[model samples]
Target: MSMDVRDLGGRPVIIGAGIAGLMTALQLAPEPVLLLSRSPLGADASSMWAQGGLAASLGDDDDPALHLSDTLAAGDGLCDAQAARRIVYAAPAAIEYLARFGVRFDRTPAGALRLGLEAAHTRRRIVHARGDGSGREVMRALIAAVGSTPTIAVIEGFEARRLAMEDGRIAGVLASGPTGPAFLATARVVLATGGIGGLFHDSTNPLGSCGQGLALAAHAGAVLADLEFIQFHPTALDGPGRPMPLISEAVRGEGAVIVDETGRRFLDGVRGAELAPRDIVARAVWKHLADGHRVFLNVRERPGPEFARQFPTIASACKKAGIDPVRDLMPIRPAQHYHMGGVAVDGSGRTSVTGLWACGEVASTGLHGANRLASNSLTEAVVCARWVAESIAGTPAHRTKPAIASDRPSPDPTTVRPLLSRALGVLRDGEALKAAARALLPPAERKDAASDPAAVGLMIAIAALRRRESRGAHYRTDFPHHAAVARRSEITLEAALAAARELAPVLEGVT
Candidate 1:
């Protein structure tokens, strides 16, 4: 496929239209930027579906140190202390930054910010907008801000398929749009392309979020960290939906309970009960479901009649499922939500690859180490967007030769979903991970539509297989205890493919 080369004249190109991408473009403003979105703004983004809001130390009783403590605890001993502290400390300011962008967060009648709560949080630090429609409100403001900014050029309906690299550095971005493939030549590229939830069968993220950013970075030889840690929300509205509707943890914070179909409070004896860190709760819910018992979020007696008023988005979803949150027992199940892994980056969001930076769910910034604290993901995105923009602004845009490319179609995660759901779900074992790695090898080696998603799955399988002990979101059933010494795992595409190749013969012979 012949490509049209569009020289951006050293203008920075930001990929993905989620909060991170929009905010990064806004931050770089007065200076020109090219923002590429696969879909229109507010669509196909996990950030647009975020209901829990941004976690900030804005409560009178709260402090950034306290927020950092909760974050470190949730991370299960693998969080980078420095990075976590920096982001958490900047969170309150980040909230203000959003407000400046015209995000009208929920405020009290007396004109004070009304904070909410979520699981694993020690304080009421969740700064939300429109109650449960936080993401919608936030995106609305950012989209408006991007539109009005004279320097940021928004290009919708463009999917970034590959990073044009030369001599181990970024040359340009090859993207597919309505007309066809176009290569935007520039030295700087920022990947804010969201999570890998679409690679799983049951997820709360948009189905389009199949880790495209990770695939691009990996193929460009960037290192990825903690690929095994995928957080499953304990209460996705249990029913049929392409991407399951999330029953926000804020509902549980508002006094909801998890019980069996028989109305027995199954998590009664668990520490922190229904409000424990996500990994623990997801495991318990997954186990209960595996035991042939139906689980439901018993909000009938707790949030009661006030449920709809506080969580309109979730309420509407429940209503669509033919259940009224004020009266009915809402069926619930664990679904893949946040991923605590991606292109490994430093404090400035600069990846190992030169001229390449990553922010949001696509970058493993060492903030959410093993598992993410509820609502912290948004805070990280907002705070890191500024840092990423600054880093890009300071770096010189080197000119490169016109990039050559074989245009490829957007990735479809269908083939890898079941494989991941079975081998890398809430419960996993070495044998299953090995089998999955072996199965994904050939597809990952190919250059077809399945290759990108398959490569991502293969990497995750290899990472999970290597991490023998249970830790946070990644649990190996065969090795159900945490190791004495905690460590973060990293893998490159080549290393992951090599690991899979080594395991294929051994697993094939055993099978």
Candidate 2:
């Protein structure tokens, strides 16, 4: 296929179509933006799969301080206080912003926003829409708004392959589409490419979300923070599904209980019980599953018949699996649900790399710390999009010359899933991590489709190996306790390669 290069006259290019990407483009408003999406509008984006609502301190009894308190406690000491405070405080405004963009949130009979509760939240502050279809509603409105806005150019069916760098800054995006390779020459770029759950066999993220943004940034000399802190949702509807259906924590907050096959409510003893922080619940569930038992979510008495009315999406999934939530026990297990780490960004969503910014799950803004509070991911994305847009709008887009990029095969995580699932799941240890790193080194250095996914997996393995203490989602069986002092971990591709090389001296090929 022939390569096509087009200059957008220094328009800031947003390389995603999720909430972060859509919100940034909308906020940039009359300013032109080249919005790219690998799949049709909301078809394969993780944002469209989000069931839990966006977190905002919208209730009368709830306050941003209270929200921040819950956030910090869930973060387990790794969240940057300033970022978490700013984002949570701005959460209410974000909800309003979404509403202004045509998102009609669930409202009370008194014409106020109806708030729901989630795990680790002290008060009911989750603002949902269309019941459990919050993400779908948000995406639908944003996609419609984007279509009507003439300034934003929507480009679907194209995937960003690489960031074309000129003098150590972004000059253009090398992307591949159905026709051929196309390079959009623009000085500024925003990455909102979602999460890395696809790297695990049992994950809740779309399979297309295999850390493409992380790989793109890492290759362009960007730093990624806390790569090992992967949040596994404890109650994913378990079956033979590749990307498991998330039995949202909202269901649990609504009174559903978790139990093992013997009809024992296993989490009864833990503080907050099924409502504990996700990492804790996931670990408990994982250990139970490892101990020759089957775990299930029992909504029989809690939501009962209202389960279908309150959470129709989940109810449909249950029906498909031949399990009635009002009668049968819904089989469940822990699955990789979210990533609390990605291209390390500051308060303004600016990465270490100039002319580049990240948002959504692909950017570690330090708000999530070690574990994400339920429903905080969407809140963070909506809250950070404004800041990202402001930073981009304020900066002048530098002129860039036409650029050329080699055609690279699309990334495939098929070879990476099992390796990551084994080494970096809910439980980890030094030996498994080291072995994963060594095993991933060869493919990471290769030029095949598995390279990018392997490279992301390798970095995660290295990060998991380096963190000696157990903190939040990153639980190392060998180091099952927190360090005396809490700290966040950061990594670059170079550092990860160096660590991998040390593990496999004379790595199979490229040293």
Model 2: worst 10 consecutive residues (lDDT sum): 1-10
lDDT of 1 by residue, 91-159 (tens): 999988888889999999999999988999989999889999999999999988888888888788889
Task: Indicate the residue-level lDDT of 142 in model 2.
Answer: 93
Top lDDT prediction, candidate number: 2
Model 2: how far is 52 from its true place, Å? 0.5
Alpha-carbon RMSD, candidate 1: 2.4
* lDDT for each residue of candidate 2 in 110-183, tens digit (9 for 90 to 100): 89998899999999999999999999999999999988988888888899999989888888899998878888
lDDT of each: 0.91, 0.92
Give model 1's TM-score versus the native structure: 0.97
